[model samples]
Target: MDAGLLAWGRAVKRRGGKIPPLWYFTDAARLADPLPVIRRLPRGLCGVVFRHDTAPGRLALGRRIAALCRERRLYLVVAGDARLAATLHAGLHLRGGRRGVLRLPCLVTASVHNAVELARARRAGAMLLFISPVNATKSHAGAQVLGAAGWRRLARLAPRGHRAALGGIDGRSIRALGQGCAAAGAIEAFYFNV
Candidate 1:
């Protein structure tokens, strides 16, 4: 982890919140094997958003990751599958604008690209909102970049301490956001060293 990110996580911890300050979002295409990366995550203060979407043996992978998360005391959330998340006893991360009801007790988060999606996420009772494309990223090539200003504007729409800056985010970019979000999510940033 970057020094800035570690510091940010520590700060968030000091503030007494359940949300982790740093997050790792998995991409099957970008990172075929994420166990090593998950092992490298700082204990207790970081979260992992397990997003293998279409990979075969996803449940097996989720179980492995869940075990690792529990051992490390890190938060874990499965992307787009409520049943899978429930089975793993982890949280659920809904994609942009998908309002999936949760009947079980677990953390519910959502990704929002715009104000409309943000409102919908809030309505769905998302405990956290990941505002994406804060900077140029290869993951979503040609997608509109929010930049620093746009990120701040959208982040303000969400209640304080419930927002996370995602997409092309790094330690430097997180600093530039000026504490705009309570947490920060990244794919490349965490995988670079792996």
Candidate 2:
């Protein structure tokens, strides 16, 4: 078990109502071996969000990831592909603008730019929401940035128990955010790597 998952597991044990921390790896190209990454995570980490556009032969890779996830007791979500989402038994994440048919009973998540989009994601059956670009991000150049204060304010209106702040998020920033969340008991789950 890695440090992140150990901390998260202890936190969950301490606070039964809180959700586990998550690590959203939006940079698919940078990921060399997804299985090792998943296995390194402790059994307690909530899940990993793998975002990639649907392509030929992608399902085979996704299925392999999903199978590894199951063995490790970690949830795997295929971001932005409803067909892959439906095929995978773990979770599904959709962007605010994408339109796709979702199969039932899998965990549903979405990215929201604002309250309106958040609402729309909820109506679409998203149980988790990733509100991104909370800070200026090199990966997503020219994207709108929502700082910590904005995240706090927006988090107030989220309907689901799970909401993660994305974009420009790094170790130092996450530490600070975790402290703030810890103080207010606002965020139960945190996703990151040390």
Candidate 3:
């Protein structure tokens, strides 16, 4: 496990919330396998969001990943696949283009980029949200970065730290960012350097 990821997991356990504070986003394009990192995480220490959308074998892969998550007691959210999520008894993570919540059996989360998207999530009854590009990210290089101050403002509009800080957050940036979220997540942060 990355020291930062471990520390983030410990932080989540320290907090008196049911939601874990650390997350690892699986991007097939960026990472070969997340299981190695997931294995290092203490059971129930973090959640995994499998986001290789449009992969031909997504359902099969989701089932396999879901089994692993169940074994480790990790919360698993299938991005853009409410049906699959529901079938596996896992949570659902709405894609960025989908602005509102859909009636589903499991927890509903949304990807929020700006204040406008935040407002939509607030109204749509999402249980969680991920506000992204908090800093420059390899996935979306040169994209708009939401500095700490801006992130704080956006977080306030959400469900009070029920959201997460995605993008470039790692150990150094996380310490600098402070307690703005119930959780912090990233692809690079967990897979490699920030």
Candidate whose lDDT is highest = 1
Runs of candidate 2 exceeding 4 Å displacement: 1-13, 17-19, 54-56, 97-99, 178-194
Preferred candidate (TM-score higher): 1 or 3: 1
Give the 10-residue window scoring lowest on summed lDDT in candidate 3: 96-105
Kindly list the per-residue Cα lDDT of model 2 for residues 3-89, writing each as its tens digit.
Answer: 443554456446553344555453445553455656665575556776646444566767877887788877676777777677787
Ranking of candidates on lDDT, top first: 1, 3, 2
CA lDDT of each candidate? Answer: 0.86, 0.60, 0.74
- Give the Å shift of residue 15 in candidate 1: 2.4
Q: What is the lDDT of residue 184 in candidate 3?
A: 79
Candidate 3's residue-wise lDDT over 1-194, tens digit each?
A: 46865786587578778776777888877765666766655687788888878666777877888888989888888787767777778887776626323467666677788988877766666667788878888888889988887787788887775767888888777665667677777776665332
Q: Which candidate would rank higher by lDDT, 1 or 3? A: 1
- Runs with alpha carbons beyond 4 Å of true place in candidate 3: 97-102, 192-194
Clashes of each: 0, 4, 0
Candidate 1 vs candidate 2: the TM-score winner is: 1
Quick one: how many clashes does candidate 1 have? 0
Provide the TM-score for each candidate, comma-separated: 0.95, 0.77, 0.89
